[model samples]
Structures are given as structure tokens and as C-alpha cells.
Target chain A: MPLPMTSNQVLDREFLEIRAKILDLAASFDRLDRADGSVVGDPRQSLVQEALSVLSSTQKDRAEQIQLLFSHHYEDDWQEKFNLPSAAKLRTRST
Target chain B: MYYFDPHIHMVSRTTDDYEMLAKMGCVGLSEPAFWAGFDRGSAESFRDYFRQLTEVEPKRAAQYGIQHYTWLCINAKEAENVSLSREVIAIIPDFLDCHNVLGIGEIGLNKNTKNEAIIFTEHLELAVRYNQQILIHTPHLEDKYQGTRMILDMLCDDSRIDRGRVLVDHVEEHTVRHVLDEGFWAGMTLYPTTKCTPQRACDIIEMYGSERLMANSAGDWGPSKPTAIPDLILEMRRRGHPESLIRKIVYENPLEFFRQSQGFTFKSPDADDASTINDRTASEPK
Candidate 1:
């Protein structure tokens, strides 16, 4: 019996929750920066920074872009490695 | 508002959960074979699990008026044990004829290991030999993208596979486009955390449109919500999407994919009920 709500109504209903999540994320970053040692040039930190930059992008497909950014690069012979009977070790990436 | 959950692990759930599902207008669901939280010891264990899928779970779901369909496989985690995995695969055909048994699935890469890939290919061969639909589970978290890539590559490489009959589940923004572009059905799993949320699913629906797409709770033993499909419906409704569009994604789309399987024979609950007799059915305008 309920009618479909408008987009503004949806945003109004979700605004506080979204704001709280943003604050939580900001607080976590603040806590991280306040810690003793710095993760300045660490690849993981760089990935996070890249992900944040993706979040600020104007692209409509930012989600896909960010997901691809965090994903493994396509290897032409990716399946060939599976031919080895032995279990694979995790592939370490420098970039 | 009737819906079908295309992928959920009801064996890990309770009768109370079934009651809740039926109460939420979930008329049907399909349970794909997956890891039982730990590595099952042997092929005999998989046989027992298959029996539960084909026999026990169907009766249990029937108690709540939910039509339960299932898939058969050793699951990717246990596929690490090649000897036991082969043993289990040999015995899977024994239950393929079970009325509730749909096909081979939740069969995919857990850690993207070589052993997992070998076993996944073997499962595909089995499904192809028997002419069954496939339900795939891509890896989670960090491994998701690569695992999905590997899965799609393998599936596409197999010329025996009919992409329309296959469902690649747990697809996200980066992976879903490829899955759909390759002509396979895609399922977005709605989890409370970790996997896709209702909001993200709504976005996917908006971007992808309703064709060959569906959503499921993926409610398993872990931190999952069994009523997540209804939650998706609520989210879709909240976004001002039409009821028809919402119903297509949550209900009709799943039915379209599931009907391709020889084992899927779903009876509408509305057929006997006086409720919504005036409403048009999903498939035919009556």
C-alpha cells in the first residue's frame, strides 16, 4: 500500500548515516596519522590514497575504477601458472 | 512482492529462518553447495551433504512452503584435496537426477590456487557431460577481481558451455560488466557487510538495467542476513524505482535463469491463494 518515495526523500533518510560513516572514516585516518611511526611511502598507504582519489573523481563509474585500481593486473599467461601441481605462493607486488 | 532467492545456503540456517523467509514473501530459493566452514574429510562426507541438499533441505523448506532447489559439487575449499575432490566428483553424477538437484555449483576458486583451478575445470567437465546449469562463486575480498577474471576466462574458453544457462554470482562493479558482456547471468550478493550492500546493488541495477541480472542474500553460516532480498526490494522502492522494475530484478530475473535448468520446476504459491488473483503474473499477463 506504500507509494514509492522520491530521490530527495531517500537522500534525506540516508544523510545522517552517510555523514556518520564519513566521520568514522575521517576519525580512523586521524587516529592512524596520530600513531608513532609513519606509513609514509608504504605501498598499502599509497593504494589507500589512490582509492580516496578515486572516491573524489567525477566519473560515474568510480566504483568500477576503484575496484580495478585495487585489482591484479591482467597477466597474459595467468592460467599457465596454474599448470604447476604445487600450491602457489601469494604474488608479491612492488607497485 | 513475491521473490526468489537464487543463491542462499539454507543448510546452515534454521527452520525459524525459513519461517521468516516465507513471511517475507520468498516463495522459492536455490542453495548451491559450498564450504561447510571446514574441510570435509572424504567423498563419503560430500555424498551425505548431497543427500541433505536433495532430500533433507527440500522437505525442510516445504514445511514453510518455500520451494528449494540445489546444486551439487565438492566446493572450492575442499577442492584443495585433489584425491578427495576427484572422488567426490565421481559420485556427484549419482545424485544429478534428484528432482531438487539443479546442477553443479558454488564451484569456483576459493584462494585462486592451481589446485582450485584444476578442480573447477573438472567440475565444469562434469556439468557439461551431464548437461547441467552452472552456478559459480567468485572469490571474496582481495582475490575477487582476479578470481572473477580467472573464472570468466575458464568459462569462456569452454565452448561446451552455454553462457545463458550459467550464473556467475558474487559479481561486483568491476567484474559484473565483464560477466554480462560475455552473455552470462550475474548475481549480486547482498550481505550486511563485506560483500555488496543494498545501496551498492541498487547502483548496479541502475547502471546495468534489469536484463539477465538478479540479487540474492547469499545468506550462509557466516555474517549474513537471510532477509536481504527483501531489504534490496526496500532499497529499490526507496529509490523511486517502479515496482515492476524491482520485481523483475528480485523475482522474474532469477526465475528466467533458473528455468533453464532441467531440475527447476517452480509452482507459484499464488496459484492456490485468493490473494493477488487480480495481479498480473511475472511471466504471463493473465
Candidate 2:
């Protein structure tokens, strides 16, 4: 696994600024996926899915990512709020 | 004796299909949302249709001891009507929570239209977002050869999707090799006309053997019968097909299919149908 961004890596301020910009781009890509539906299918969604997967591994760095990568979906946790049907509905039923 | 139909259309079929199918040892069926004969005017049409599929019908099937599952999506062939399909596909995720829906699917290219391809890609996106398996529909008749090829090509070209996560349904001699060779699951339809017959399908089983292969009855408004799968199995048994091969083609194949899918878990088998014997009447299920 890649090492997490330390206080110095992010505290450099210049790199944090760049990470913030990338996170903004990620947020924009996520919005495009929401509005266009096709965006989530774009090859870029693979990158985002990967980045999101990686963000789960580290702690303090993960917190920084929570602020960086997910401006809307993370901040809102809207997937839960949206009230999708219960997972059981999709379950295979008794014959 | 556990039979599974990975592709079926419940809109045109009746409750008796569940009863008869259950009695015939058909324990479960996956109903793909599709063009049910004519076109609809609004998103509300699809809403009501989804309601009937996920709510009204499954309860009816459960009453008869058959498990009814659904693949939710806008039909691909009608995706020529892209504007409406987009509207319908847009709302499909809202209905995903209904206990019977398996995924946003039975979606793919038809007429090989750019607009249809766009919709197909979007549906793929939805599956990825929701983490669900895809049930793709390859066009029929004249469109079969080229359309199936086109759908698989798009899936391959799209790096975000995996071949194993999709079911490229409605295979014939022309497309079965490519579908299986590509490592995607292949589904065969047993329509009396337009699709393969039981004898021919069994012959395909003999030739292709089995890997990621399943057979279904896309019984719809046409003269097609819902008993197509049963006929294929019956013919296979009559022609000296080993019981294991029949189980592999029908029961094991589909069961393993849903089992591999994301967020999908097995529903209990209808444990209460002790009264219904496996001896089914010869009449067709309407």
C-alpha cells in the first residue's frame, strides 16, 4: 500500500493546494456522473472508484481525503438519504 | 430438481405460469424488464410497469410457491426511442429497492443506433454505481448476428465494466461462441419461432457443452410458449442427456449466476409447496 500523506506532505501547503484542486475536479466528475449518468460509465469513473477505494486504507490521510475527494457525496452521504429500496427486495426469494 | 430461469418476461405471462412452473420443479425465475409489445407515452407508464413487476407480481408468484425476481431497465430494442428511455432509465434506480429487482438491465444495443449505444452505456454506469449485475439483451432475428457482436464489443471497449458481471442474453449459433469465448455469461432463448427450438438448443448444448451458459423462455405477446425451457430439458432427457448436464444447463448455471452477482443473496426456496407435484399438465402456461 502507498504511504499516507503526512503533516509535512500536506502541510507543505503547496501540495495540499494541489490535492484540493484535484478533489474539486473529482467532485466535478462526480456531479457530471450524476447529471449525465454516462459520466459514471466514463473510463474516469474507474479512476475515481480506485481513488475512493484507496482512501479507505489510511486514517488521518483518509480524513483529509474525506474533505478533498468527496465534496458532495461524502459531505451529504446522500446515497443513504435518498432512501433506496431495502436490499432484501432484490434478494432471491423462496420458490 | 431445482430449476432456475435466469431470463423470463412476467408481464405477458400469468399467475398460472408460477403455479405450473413451481409444480414442474422450477424454483425461481428472473424477469427482465423489457418492451412488452407496444410503446408507452410517459415515464409514468414505466413506473406503473415497474410497480406491477416488483410488487403485484412477486406476491402472486409467492402465493403459488415460485420465486419471482426482476431485472429492472428500459428495453434495448425500443431504445431507438432514446429520449423516453433516458427518462425511464433515470428513474430506474429509485425502484431498485423493491424486493424483487435484481439490477438495471436487459439493456443493450439494438438497430446498432448511436443513441441506443449511449443509453446502453448509461445503464452500465447505473449498474456500476449501484453495484449490480447487468442483464443485457441482444436484438433478435436479423439484428441477432451483428447486434450481439456490437453489444459485446461495447462492453469490452468500456474498460469500466467487467464481462463476468453481465449476461448477454438471446444467443444463437452465430453469437454463442464469441459470448462464451469472451468470458461473458451467455443466455439462450427457446422461442418456437425466431429463436432456437428445444432440439436445436440441446444440440447447441452438445456442441458447446457448458460454461457461463443458460437457457430461458422469452415468452411474450408472440406465439412463443413459456414452457420452452421445460421442453428443452425434457427433450434433453428423452435424447439421453445425462441428468447432470441438464442440471448444469438449467439449475446450476442460473443459481451460480445470481450467486456471483453483487449485492445479490439467495431467497428461500418455497418450502411450503408440498401439495404441488412436479407432474405438470401438457397445456401451455399463458
TM-score of chain B of each: 0.95, 0.91
Report the C-alpha lDDT of model 1 over B1-286, residue by residue, as the tens digit: 9999999999999989988998999989999999999888778988899999998888777767788999999888888899999999999999999998889998999888888888998898899889999999999766888889888888887777899999999998788998999999999998765567787788778778899999999999998999999999998898689999998998899888889888988887768774422222222321
Per residue, candidate 1 scores C-alpha lDDT tens digits across A1-95 of 76599889988877645643443343335435544698889998778768866244435455566556656765546776755321122112211
Weakest 10 consecutive residues of candidate 2 chain B by summed lDDT: B275-284
Off by over 4 Å in 1: A1-54, A84-95, B273-286
Q: Model 1 chain A, poorest ten-residue lDDT window?
A: A86-95
lDDT of 2 by residue, B12-100 (tens): 88767777877777777888888877888888899999998887766666666566788888887778787898899888988888777
lDDT of 2 at A57: 44
TM-score of every candidate? 0.80, 0.69
lDDT of each: 0.82, 0.70
Place model 2 in a CAPRI quality band: incorrect
Q: Predicted candidate 1: interface RMSD?
A: 8.4
- Regions of model 2 farther than 4 Å from truth: A1-95, B267-286
How far is B76's C-alpha from truth in model 2 (Å)? 1.5
Write candidate 2's Cα lDDT for A1-95 as tens digits: 86587768666746534544443343344334334246436677677668767433423223224332322121122213333221222222311
